[model samples]
Target: MIVGVVSDTHDDQEAVAKAARLLLEQGAELVLHLGDIVAPFTLRRFSREGVKRLIAVYGNNCGERLGLLRTAESLGYEIHDWPHVVELAGRRIVMVHGKGPAGETRELVEALARSGRYDAVLYGHTHEVDVRRVGSTLVLNPGEACGCLTGRRTAAILDTETMEARVLEL
Candidate 1:
């Protein structure tokens, strides 16, 4: 299965639209938003035809949690707290928003990747793209889709069959 990973959208409608299109073009059947979605309208941009499921976790910046949750439910999507875990394509995956100080978040992400409990750990918050393997697990942060920081809007495509992923500029 092809899974699309995005993080820190920060309410950029255009970037989110482009990213959604790009992910569908890349044959992504599932889409995961790590966090910083910000608004319900911006979150709706990810509701595309090709994506079978959309799951998101709460970021520190997500103040309108109730609205976001309502919208997600209306769209048949899911909104969860941070560090949510699920099995997909026969692999255990943990998703988090990467809250806390920058260094601490990075350390936590790496720790989760190295803990040997999950096949993949997805996170965002630093607004920096990180895709690497820690031991046997895949750890990825698709960067900031809003392009507010780093001036680069990015997303990621993960191929579950091969356990490979790539960050793409959007």
Candidate 2:
């Protein structure tokens, strides 16, 4: 299964649409947003046709929490809580915004990735794209989808079968 990973989309509608289009074109069955989605309208980009699911978590900047939830509910989507765990294609994929106590440190994140607790640890906060391996787990961050801080908008496509991640620049 090919899953799309996105994060830190600080309400850049164009960037979000672009990333979603690319991911859908690339045959992404499911799309996961790591957070910082800002507004509910921005979340609509992930609801593109052909995408099976659009799941998200709140980031530090998601001020309109109620509106966000309402928008998602109206759209038949789900916004999970932090450190959301999802099973895709038989892989234990963990999604988080990389905030709070569980993901504040690189060491802690690495430890979680290497703890044999999950197959993939997906997060975003630093606005940098990274794909690394710790023990048997895959640690992936799709960077800033809005390019707000990094000046480079990006996302990633992860293949559950091979555990390979391909970063996409938008």
Candidate 3:
């Protein structure tokens, strides 16, 4: 399975579209948005070609939470809260928005991955791309799809069979 990872959209529809396109071109079957999505309408941009599943979590700036859920529901999708966990391809994966006091979120995410309780920990908030290994766990942050701050649009594609994460700059 090829999973697409995106974060910190910040309501930039254009960037989201580009990122989604890149993910699709790379053969992403599942797409995960780590938050900072901003508006419900932004979710529409991700409903593009060749995406099997679109999963998302709320970020610190998730305004109109209920509306977001409604939008997703209307589109036949679901948006979860932080620390969402699931087993995919026989591996436990933890998904989080990573919104909180500075280093605290990073520490918690790192701890969760280091505890060996998950095969991969996917998070976003800092708008900086990061990929690391903690024990047997893989920690990945796909950076900011909106590229509001860093000006570099990015995402990641994770190969479930090989546990490899490839960062994509759009």
Candidate 4:
């Protein structure tokens, strides 16, 4: 399965729509967002624009900007409060906002890797697109949809079967 990964949207409706549209056009079957959408409608917009099977986790800014659990539930989106884990297409995916200690976070992810529990760990908060393999697991951060401050908007596409990731500039 090919899944589109994105993060730190920060309310750029246009960019979000464009990214969703493009990914859909590219034949992405699912969309996974790491953090910082800043509004519930962003996900709705992506769904409206053509993305199916949307999954997301919250950012530090999500409390006030995004919908509550019930709202997200109604929208057919699984909104992870924080530190969530899900399995898809035979690959285990763990997602967090990555706001705490990088060393500890990496250690925890590495531990998970040791268990062969996941295929990837996705995070957002640094606004940097990164993909690396930690032993058998892939650690990824799609980073900053509109470049909030850095002007570097990007997204990632992961092929679950191949465990390959492709980064795209929006």
Candidate 5:
């Protein structure tokens, strides 16, 4: 199964739309957003035809939590708080925004990957692309889809069968 990973969209509709299209073209069956969506309108951009599901977590900048939840529910999407754990394609995965008052930093993300509790740990906050393996787990941060900080809009495609991921420039 191919899973698309994205993060820190930060309300860039153009980037979000492009990212979604690119992921779908890459044959992504599901798309995961690590958060910082910013607003409900930005969340709607994932409503593309080919995506089977869109799951997102709350980031530090997602102040309008209620609105995000409502929009997600209406779109038949799934939105959760930080550290959301789920199993996809028979692989255990944990998704987090990797920031906020809880101080979920890069260390925390690495720790989760090293713990061997999950097959992949996906996070974003620093808006930097990071893809590596810790023991038997994969730790990935798809960078900033908004291109606000890195000046490069990007996303990622993860192959569950091989447990490999590649960053794609949007």
Candidate 6:
């Protein structure tokens, strides 16, 4: 499976659209959005005019933005309300928004890995793309789609068959 990953799309419409377009052009079978999808229209517009199959977690910004989920729903995507688990290509993945603390991202993955509950962990908060293997599991972050902070819009592509991750700058 070709999985597309992105996070912290803090409401940059153009970058989000471009990222989704590239993912689709690459024939991504699934897209995992890490979080900080600021406004409803971010996801809403994507659903209406861009992406198709998207697995998204709500960010800290999302909690403060009311009715955003409803907007996304109306746009045709189901936003996962909290920590979610999904299976893809025989691999289990745990997804989170990553709002706990600085080093908590690693801790969360470590804890989850220790439980043997998942084969991969995906989270977003820090606007930095990272891919690391933790024991038997993969820890991945797709960075920020908005490009507000880093001045570069980015995303990730994970090839399940090879267990390889490629970062895409939009």
In Å, residue 94's CA in model 4 sits off its true spot by 0.8
What lDDT does candidate 2 reach at residue 35? 89
Sorted on lDDT, best first, the list reads 1, 5, 3, 2, 6, 4
Compared with the true structure, model 3 gives a TM-score of 0.95
Better of 3 and 5 by lDDT: 5
Best by TM-score: 1
lDDT of each: 0.90, 0.85, 0.87, 0.78, 0.90, 0.79
Tell me the tens digit of each residue's lDDT in model 6 across 44-77.
7677556877878888888644577677566666
- Cα lDDT tens digits for candidate 1, 1-170: 89999999998888888888999899998899999999998767777434458999999999999999999998889999989997889999999997778898999998899899999999999999999999999999999998998999999999988999999999
Per-model TM-score versus the true fold = 0.96, 0.92, 0.95, 0.88, 0.95, 0.89
As a TM-score, model 4 comes out at 0.88
Candidate 3 lDDT trough over 10 residues, lowest sum: 44-53
RMSD of each predicted structure = 1.2, 2.1, 1.2, 2.2, 1.9, 1.9
Can you write out model 2's per-residue Cα lDDT over 1-170, one digit (the tens) per residue?
99899999898888888888999988898888898998988866667534457889989899999999998887877887778899988999888887655336455568679789999999888788889999889999989988888799999999999999999998
Q: How many residue pairs of model 3 clash at the backbone? A: 0
**Model 2 clashing residue pairs (backbone):** none
lDDT (10s digit) by residue, model 4, range 1-170? 98888988877998898789777876788888887777777777787887767888888777654364555677777788767887888888888776665565556656765677778888777787778888888888876887776788888888989988888888
lDDT of residue 28 for candidate 6 = 88
Q: What is residue 95's positional error in candidate 4, in angstroms?
A: 1.2
Clashing pairs in 6: none
Candidate 1 lDDT (Cα, 0 to 1): 0.90
CA shift at 3, candidate 2, in angstroms? 0.5
Model 4: residue 52 alpha-carbon error in angstroms? 2.2
Stretches of candidate 4 exceeding 4 Å from the true structure:
65-68, 100-116
What total of clashing residue pairs does each candidate reach?
0, 0, 0, 0, 0, 0
* Angstrom error at residue 14, model 6: 1.3
